[model samples]
Target: MEYDYHCTVCRGHLRIGNKLVFSAKTRDNKYGLIFLSPELGDYTTEHHPDFDIQEGEEYLFYCPICHARLNHTENEKLVRIFMVDEKGAEYEIFFSGIAGEKCTYRMRDKEKEELGPDSEKYRQYFDLPDEYRKYL
Candidate 1:
């Protein structure tokens, strides 16, 4: 089934079949979208490039609207994004990043993780073991 993404903070529609996109950042501070936040602006401009990955690095995804970090946790691999399946079951989409723009869906939990660790404490903050496979 198809899944939909939204900003946990603002409840803003993020992903709905090419409608909106989400923002992502690498440890080195590069930024891109798993999808576009909107159709009007180009986030991957000359001034900014997609994340450059190296051995043993972490990446992050966040809400472009609130600028709130989505994939920040003690466990560096798993990044959670608020998602709702087509059936209307809400879930936390755990995307595990391996390298630059290369990642996999590690898990999909109806039990949500903290979308914001420092500022917005989720019901249960992600603290899983950092032992993800190369690609899901």
Candidate 2:
């Protein structure tokens, strides 16, 4: 679903595609949802040391326009992230930490490694954006 919107922070025109789910554990041990590009595939699952997150908590999904963090809410059992662009248009997307049956091993391993602080790449993985970052 393409959205005609504007950035709430920068007031820039925002064109967003379909709602893609990116799941990770939050610092508070809660499941978090991040909206990102569907084309992103399993790229966010890659192990990086900079991104640190705990399962099942809230976190910011950076706005592409203003680079500010977007607000998250639980919508119909799915975690949804909401953002308004410069044009006052609102966009919402959903996600979950639990993987579907079709999920790939590469994506699962990447998420596991990122969530495991003992993993050598944990620190580096925490640095990535919430949509791409892994949680322990």
Return the top candidate by TM-score: 1
lDDT of 1 at 110: 31
lDDT of 1 by residue, 1-136 (tens): 4557767678777765655565767766777765543222222211133344444456576787887776645445655566676688776555444333323232344333332222222223333333542222
lDDT of each: 0.50, 0.37
Candidate 1 clashes: the total is 1
Instruction: Give stretches of model 2 more than 4 Å off.
Output: 1-47, 72-91, 94-136
Checking candidate 1 for backbone clashes, the offending pairs are 21-36
Q: Model 2 reaches what TM-score against the true structure?
A: 0.28
Best by lDDT: 1
For model 2, residues 17-116, the per-residue Cα lDDT tens digits are 5543333444455444444444312324331344454443345444555654433332112333444444655544333332221121112213422212
TM-scores of all candidate predictions against the true structure: 0.52, 0.28
State the local distance difference test value for candidate 2: 0.37
